[model samples]
Target: MSIAWDDALKVGNIEIDADHKELIGLVGDFETMVKSPKSVTPRSIQITLERLQLYAHDHFAREEYIQAIAKYPGLAENKRQHDALRKTLADYIAKFEAGQFGDLGKAADEMAAFLNHWLMSHIVDVDMKMRGALSDEGWR
Candidate 1:
């Protein structure tokens, strides 16, 4: 399945929206790379996972910074979710390193689906709250 970024994913913050777009693109690239298992090595997958982790870290920091600046009430919850996602990514990396998933394509498909769902849900349900706060404060 191909995932595309659309208006539904926008959180009403330009910076966060751009970051999410980049993240979605990265995840799509990773998904494509893994779909052709024979064409990519395990090391390649590891690198992609690392890249995703790094990008996610940066994105979370940016989002948190905005939330802090805006005094967003849901900042704590956002941080909690971000931390959970980081842990989940780490677990996936560990599993990959351990050769726990023999079928890389299958694993990638699952990972892509999870990431897509998590991202969309977070943007819509969680991040949108920040947008609302910003709107209330005339920041949006």
Candidate 2:
């Protein structure tokens, strides 16, 4: 599937929205790497997984920082979700490294779906709420 960024994925906040855009791009890159015929190797997949993990960890930190600064009421719940995603990614990587490529396709597909749902649900539902609270508090 083509994972292109669109306005539909935006959370209506410039900083977080931009981060989300870049995140989707990285995800798309991973998808491309996974689908490449000649270039698809275990090493390449490992690199993609590493990049995704790094970017995602950084993004989650920034997002949580924003939530903390804004005193967002759902910070705990949102962090639980973040922790879950991180754990899942780590588990997937561990499996892949254990010579378990059989489920790589399915894992990648699930990752993409999870990301899409994050963009749709978390962005609109949680991020938007946090953004509104921050804006109302006169945060730039």
Candidate 3:
């Protein structure tokens, strides 16, 4: 299943919301590549993962910076969650590089599910808090 970006994912912060939209688009691209007849390869998956990781790192930094500027109370927890996601991505990349997951299709499915869940939950539960704080400070 493809993950579509919609109003439900918006967090009221323009930069973060734009980043989230890009992230969702990247995931959609990954899904398409994985499900395509001639484009699904381990190398392609690795490249997609790299792109997602890079974007995620940048987005997290931006979000953290905003949180710091806004003095958001949930900054620490947000950092923790970001760290956990980074670790998870690193582990998955290592496993993929080591040929641990024999089935690319299954791995792709798992990755899509994990990313969709993480992004949605983080946006709703964690990011929205930052938005609230920023809005209160007239920063949003």
Candidate 4:
């Protein structure tokens, strides 16, 4: 199933929300390819997956930097979560390289699940707290 973008995914941060929207769109595209037998190709899926991985790293780095400048107290834990995701994605990429390209379907599904869980839980639960702290510090 494709993940739909909705207001529930927003964190009230304009820049981050825009990035999240784009990320969701990419995830949706991957889902579409996963279910389309005629469109599936190792090259295409690898490119998409690599793009997502690169963008994820860039997004996380930018977020961490912003959180740091904003004096978000939970930055450490948030950074840890970012690191964990990077590692997991790297592992998934390795699996693709090992003649498991057909696993794109499973990978896409798992990625969608992780994205939803992480966004809702981390953005709302943890990230919001950090944002509050940052605002309190008059950093934003």
Which candidate should be chosen as best, given lDDT against the real structure? Answer: 3
lDDT of each: 0.78, 0.69, 0.80, 0.68
Model 3 scores what on Cα lDDT? Answer: 0.80
- Give a tens-digit lDDT track for model 4, residues 90-129: 8877877787645656665665565555445545665556
Q: Candidate 1, overall lDDT? A: 0.78
lDDT of 3 by residue, 84-126 (tens): 8788878878888899986778878887787777667667677
The TM-score measured for candidate 1 stands at 0.85
Which has the better TM-score: candidate 1, or candidate 2?
1
Cα lDDT for residue 1, candidate 3: 53
- Provide TM-scores for the models: 0.85, 0.78, 0.89, 0.77
Clashing pairs in 2: none
Query: Could you tell me the TM-score of candidate 4?
Result: 0.77
Worst 10 residues of 3 by lDDT: 131-140
Quote the positional error of residue 138 for candidate 3 in Å.
4.0
Alpha carbon deviation, residue 134, candidate 2 (Å): 3.8
Model 4 is weakest, by summed lDDT over 10 consecutive residues, at 130-139
Q: Pick the candidate with the highest TM-score.
A: 3
lDDT of 1 by residue, 2-35 (tens): 5688887777777888998998898888778866
Clashes of 4: 0
Winner on lDDT between 3 and 4 is 3
